[model samples]
Target: MLEGKPICGGVRVARDEPIRYVCADCGHMTTTRTGRCPSCGAWGTLESEASSAPSKRSVAARVVSAVDVRPPRRLSTGIGELDRVLGGGLVPGGVVLIGGQPGIGKSTLLLQAAGRVAGTGASVLYISGEESEAQVALRAARLGVASDRLLLCCGTDLEGALQNLWDVSFVVLDSVQAMRAEGEAGWPGTPNQVRAVAQRVVDAARAGDVPAVLVGHITKDGRLAGPMLLEHMVDAVLTFSGEGYSSYRMLRAVKNRYGSTDELGVFEMREDGLIPVEDKSGLYWNRSDAAVSGVAMTIALEGTTPLAAEIQTLAGPTVFPYPRRTARGIELNRFQLLTAVIEKRCGLPCSGHDLYMNVAGGLSIQDPSADLAACAALASALRDVPLPGGSCWLGEVGLAGEVRPVTRLGVRLREAARLGFSRAVVSSRERNERVEGLEIVAVSHLNQALAAGLSRKEA
Candidate 1:
């Protein structure tokens, strides 16, 4: 019908077939009817478009399925610790998200990852929206990329950068915060803009089967600076957590969709690059024999690896009306809980004292097994007595002052034994191998643990 000619006040036209749809997902159009949009492999979200161009995914899926990907692509991070967290090596088409605080080396880690990927002779396209082309080149110089497989693009437009996906296997978005589409009004990294741009980038990746790694910026509150959907959209979320004060940085896999989330990659930030810390236990336990006050070894787990860390506590008379409580690498409530236990059970005057605790190597020990170390540290400080240098503590301290056992006690015990700790204290029922050259102290209750740790100190 002609425009405005119908008695119903609307023009109408009849067609033999349903109109072709361009999937907002893959941005590809199809006339075929199905619940799933074939262009981008998304479930739905298809609009009108006319295109006869067959999908590259379909064509490659058939022929490439016959070829073995494992034969050609091999992952060698050059950093052994990073390699371990990644589960042997980087798999093709696997998306990884790396997040950190500002100036915390998010870009540096990717540059290092790029060097490692390029080192394996894999072609990598590094798309930088934050930095000028020249700035990226300067960083590359400092990074020292020896492989010729690395490609750099300093363009801010996602559509332009994605056009080169066929030539490269992996894409590194230096940062998703700075990318913007043409004619988009809102600022880059805003909620609406981030969602739109992210969807487009994700669509392009899915359609092209190109594995993309994005560096996401975290807000000042230490949370991801985008819609919560961003975290759900990614395959894995890695947090590069460390203090700016120290050169030691840790690569912890906070979330992994396809692998174990508990894995970790430890690195040391140096003038050259991020050096992987392979033997983390050795680093934390190096001064085990120094007889340092306010320090005690605690065994904990990062993913599956069991390691020992030195927990330090400082106690002194409060100088102000409000007692000071400062904690690092551990939760504040946890320290307060231990203090309450010590005061209620052991009768230590911890309520009026200022308390501070630190986990060595700038690595956070979240496992409850470190509770005993925390209590021992507090006791040592309260008594003004140093904890024995050759002693390491484990076991969770309960409200009623009982030492609760932890899992993988054997691993923690072995680590303590390996580091030459002369004595190890844990819950009575814990599973630990009796190793030579060390004394293992199994305590049934909190009083026993405190007594054993303090008895030697006062004597």
Candidate 2:
């Protein structure tokens, strides 16, 4: 109908077509014109773009016959702990992401590795986006990094650094959160920018066949502070965890495309930098001359390395209606379950006591083999009796109070023997291989284990 049919002269108005809005924070796609991103609720982070291109009807592909291939050569970081966590060493063209809390020595460890690599006549690039050149130089000097082949570059100019990436044998990005792509719409550390920067850096490293290590920041919740895609884009993800003020730090591999993820690395922060802990068992044990109640030793295996940890439990009479149970370095639920087993199976009255269990040396233990040791400690604590001296426990305690066999029993016993433990309380089903100096006190039930592990009371 014509506008002028019944009313005064009227003109048609024009409207602009809606543009596609993509969230720079979470990469959420939508056509909404809201000022705030409907996905992540980040204001003004919606970037406008032209309509998406038409989907291609078809694409071509090439098929090739499968062939056998040898493993890639690994470049050692010269840090034993780091190397172990990385399953030997870094692979050429492989990208490794290391995430940790702020001031947790992420930068310090990488710098130390870079220096060691440079000392071997291999050129290394130290890219710093969080710190300026002078600051890095000062820290390097303080750390005694005097390698001539190490080159330092400052700023978030990732493109500029990639230009000379091939010239260096190794590249270490101080952090991925601080780096940004040249044309990315979001600010540095944003999901879009972090994803883009990580992809480009990974591509450059692969294309140049250079090993790259990227230090990442951890969110308050302890996850890597970036898009989740960043973790998937890398070849391996190593997470550094420990108290901020503690001298010890643990590096664990969450993902490894080339090796086993079960491997772990332990390092002690010293004045020089992070140093590998060679004797891990000695880290958690305090040897004494006399037998002690409420303290039992156990061997926990990390990858192939056996670590001896002391399990100490204290059980005291509780006045509260419900007895209190506190656990440190071990799961609270697990401790509670063990207590129930002891109370029901061994006739121990732990239900009316306040129980506290701690793994010495502040190291968290996940090995189920520690169950026997924990049981022994709890029994010793409740009975006010001391366990036999020079004895270590290694077995899993089942819900039925049966001592269950654990994996690598031989390996664990060997480690205990090496650490001066003469007797071991293990599952009755374990092999009776006669070690030169160690004795296996195999027991089928928790009470038998307690009897074998704990010495009898004086007559």
Candidate 3:
């Protein structure tokens, strides 16, 4: 027997051949050994693995007709919000990888979902490599998730735990990082081990025609804590995000083979469990009748859902030579850019004032359409004037102060109208369509938008 470790226990490399190295953090492959991984910039993560030769045996490739194919049926996770983010629901034999920070409700969400799936009279196997049965049981009890069909297994042997997949309708592995394969070298969470565990789970789920959800841990930098191959091997990748201080959580699909990645799911964490939030717009808007300075509203779209977002700003004389610019829920650079645009284009003296901006309800706004609203809020704060009541701002503000049209204008206007906003200020270039009971005030430049939004008389 040759004194070498074979990748597949069959082939071996020559003694003189150069060894290949794989980055444990990102699965970047290179023949040359290096101290740091070039891909992920992680130090000392590259490990040498023996390369194998291709076998001479050939198998015929099987081809299928596209016309004969049918779409896979989706299984509901018993949560409408989750199902929405999942593109309707889970497809049979599909593997979903959900990653999040600790205490961000990844496990809690999965546990509740598992209980729901089990409630439909389908056997659900909950495999926990990190938590013991007692701990999971305690959580289940607290969540009021008592389903006779929900099974629990607490161990690190991923192969052994997956053996019950044949008898279960749905399966969940509480963290893939902690699970180890029987034959894989290195401990669990090592690049090799993570790859092996994920591959085995994918194979088992496909073979058994069962849907499986895997929990993944994130690095300090917030990326998934494993080889990048782990994310590629999964059918879908979902990210759970929320601020620790806030009870609201957002679930988004970064990659989905069966559905759209644009969908978003909103949840509110409560004592009972994760409850789906229906009126997502209401969560971000105060709907206050008392018009306050520095407050502006915008109809922002999250996926296909329209949200009513409120932008608040505060501008005061700064003692420091460089006025401070602080922002929450929106990027600081964006805030600064808007302030500069306001000063240069709108003739608002924002440089001398220490600017502070925030999106109400702790909801982050990524929509460029909110640019007009943000600018309005900043100007209103600088002038200590409140925006006209029952008005909404919608349009992207250009560096030249041009009010650019945004996508899905109809959807946004309808949402604004539904929220009881009497008028919306938008780009004049946009093709205006009448939304019942909602007035549309179109402006081609930021100056017109500001005038319409801040003017005491309704436009």
Candidate 4:
């Protein structure tokens, strides 16, 4: 009898071809018979009892639900807001990796996550492989962390840190780059040291049923410091992203092995520490109200929610042979394309227009849903008029100046409607020709849409 371990178990017997599957690691093939991979040496890449004989009983192993695994003992990082981003709460024995720019709140976030999880009665071992114990305690005191369960260990030695920890179910290594393995001679943050130390700690956590969190440093070019492959090795990759100059900090989940990757946790940095943005819309509206030129409300989508953010555009005739195009959150050529479409579709004659766009409150508008908003703002600034009150804008403006439809138009409408927006300028394909209870203006072309916005403003 030939015996071999299955990559993930549940194999089949087939006609003499040798049960085969490709390695997810190196793209190497296994005949479901090899004990260890010859090409990459990665374990669990072969199937169990996959016979090369023809015609055998076939049984399937269904994929197990996440719930099938026992619930991880959640550790509340005293920060309730950060915890929510971890999907209800942190899963026991789950390793989380957080990266950010220098001094952009990696320590603050981990300390906060520590305090919150500690506050929830879970033990938290904070291994500050970067800063000294005195420095960590000083910062913790300043951050108002008084939890007794939050244990602080100041060490840069990877093996020592993990060995000293016992019965402690949660570990946090601030800035994984700072820790070096026992025999590693590379600089602390070098690629070799970072990968070896991080993996060793992560493996220790899983073996001991302890969840570990690692804070990471960024490259000179703004990428997570260390090897690029390091990011792919973690259970989750979260980044504290935003303009470093702004108080608004966004916890964006780029890769999540456990939850929805697109999910984000918003926060505001204050002297008191990082505060969760509970009512993002309300925070968005924190800016004072004024009918300023080049300013308009645009609906932008963040995951499932459509945000009616303020869009500010500046238009002045350019005298240069080649007009300059500068934008922040919105794309540059996209702005240029929309402007060209506006001229061709609406005959707005924006040839002399110098358009600058800003998504209000320091937030980014990555979706095309803001195309019409850009057009509307440019129109308002160009025509020197204030758009009608209680009016909202949606849909993307195509290169031909047509109002292109978007996904989840109904949600956009409902969001606008809930905000007491009396009228919504939407693309034609949203609903039947008309929507009930609210006035919906459908435009299939960009010119018609521009005319709609310009008409009410001109009126």
Could you tell me how far off, in angstroms, the CA of residue 31 lies in candidate 4 after the best superposition? 24
Clashing pairs in 1: 22-47, 262-303
Query: Which regions in candidate 2 have their CA more than 4 angstroms from the true location?
Result: 1-66, 455-459
Residue-by-residue lDDT tens digits, candidate 3, 111-169: 99999998889999999999999999999999988788999999998878987878888
Give the per-residue lDDT digits (tens) of candidate 4, residues 367-398. Answer: 88888878888778777777766667888887
The candidate 3 region of ten consecutive residues with least summed lDDT is 1-10
TM-scores of all candidate predictions against the true structure: 0.77, 0.88, 0.91, 0.79
Local error of candidate 2 at 144, Å?
3.4
* TM-score of decoy 4: 0.79
Q: In model 4, which runs have C-alpha deviations exceeding 4 angstroms?
A: 1-80, 282-289, 414-420, 432-438
User: Which regions of candidate 3 fall more than 4 Å away from where they truly are?
Assistant: 1-18, 319-321, 457-459
Better of 2 and 3 by lDDT: 3
| lDDT tens readout by residue for model 2, 1-459 | 353233335645443455897765566789877888777787876778678445768576766555655567899988988888888898999999999988778899999899889889999999999999889888888788767798988999899988878679899998899988989877899877898999999999989999999999998888888766678889999998888667888889999997889887888988888888888887788787777789988999888889989999998898888999999988999999999999999898886899999999897889999999999999999988988888889989999999999999888878887889898888889877566699878899998888766555432
- Which sections of candidate 1 miss by over 4 Å? 1-78, 132-134, 182-187, 282-294, 317-326, 347-356, 360-362
Model 3 C-alpha lDDT versus the unseen true structure: 0.90
* Comparing 3 and 4 on TM-score, the stronger one: 3
